[model samples]
Target: MTEYKFSDRAYTKMIFHAAKYPHLAINGVLLAEKGAKSNSVVIVDAIPLFHQCLYVTPMVEIALMQVDAYAERENLVIAGYYAACENFYDNTLDKVPAAKIADKIQENFKGACFAIIDNKLVTLEQEEVALKVFSCNDGGRWSKSNYSLQNSKSTLEAVSVLLKRGAMKDVVDFDNHLDNPKHDWTNELLNKDLKQIMAMY
Candidate 1:
């Protein structure tokens, strides 16, 4: 099985994106570099795409084009897609929103993965990763896949501290950028802050 390693930046940003809009469905893309090992994927960052009308194609297409360009510039690939279900209890593969997007990612990147935010584990008290990953098989089916965090315990602790500090508000998604171009969905500042914060934990 291919090993997917999620960085603290990618993991926390996805969680923050979902926490930023608890009642809404959120979706995003994962950017990654091929790991040193042949069957390993290193997910480095996440670009939050939308929280409104996930099924809309025009906006999704626009966001994807931009993300693809950005990934190219950064020497990364669109390795995966992630979604957070509006219904807190919906953590299954069938409940993943914008699933076709995941399929499209897989079409381009054979190692593409789909991750669903496990809402039950989204709390500050939660110690484990809140994401449940699935990989597309040769049969065109999504099956549960294993993933690891960069620094499991410290990552969880830092996220909890960030949540307590209400840092999630700093995470901007494509919808926010669309509403106001000044809102940077790339989250350069937040990414820097997260790295600094993680180091302290």
Candidate 2:
């Protein structure tokens, strides 16, 4: 429910975000009609307060279908699928590097609502942001966390330049969670560079 104005900043973010998607498609995991029509998903046109974005509120629609299994319930209930992926063909499909357009979304133009990534339905927010950033950034490809979000048009790249100077320690990695994942880049050049810049914080 955060409403944003239709300004250059907002348009810039929309362009970066929408460049990955061409159009919306189905989730591709519907049960056989005779098997159990219990769990269902729906796509609704969202008249958003910010940028007039479209959102696919899956849980609300699935609940209307009436399923009894908690696992199945949790398995597919999401609110942003239609706006994120094209078909959600597979779970391992990470295509952050493939989005082709970056045209900024107009303030109240009613943008599409979805929740897929690399072309698969997803529920992880940070991962989604990471994927979007991964799509927007060109020239070099690497994954980092808010360190990059700090570089969004809203932040005006000020944070990125600062981090490039010398920053803080214990910076949040893109994969940071209850327990840090070992595969994540740490003690790397970007981390060292950012840590140094964070000294100003």
* Residue 103 C-alpha lDDT in model 2: 15
Best by the TM-score measure: 1
For each candidate in turn, the TM-score is 0.96, 0.19
Counting clashing residue pairs in each candidate, in order, gives 0, 25
Against the correct fold, how does model 2 do in TM-score? 0.19
Stretches off by above 4 angstroms in model 1 are: 34-38
lDDT of each residue in 146-179, candidate 1, tens digit only: 8999999989998998898888889999999999
Find the 10 residues in a row with the least total lDDT in model 1: 33-42
lDDT of 2 by residue, 1-201 (tens): 111112222222222232323243212111111222212212211111111122233532332233213214444321222123444543232532111111121111122112223443122122223222211123322222121223334332434333233332223222231134462322244334434543444
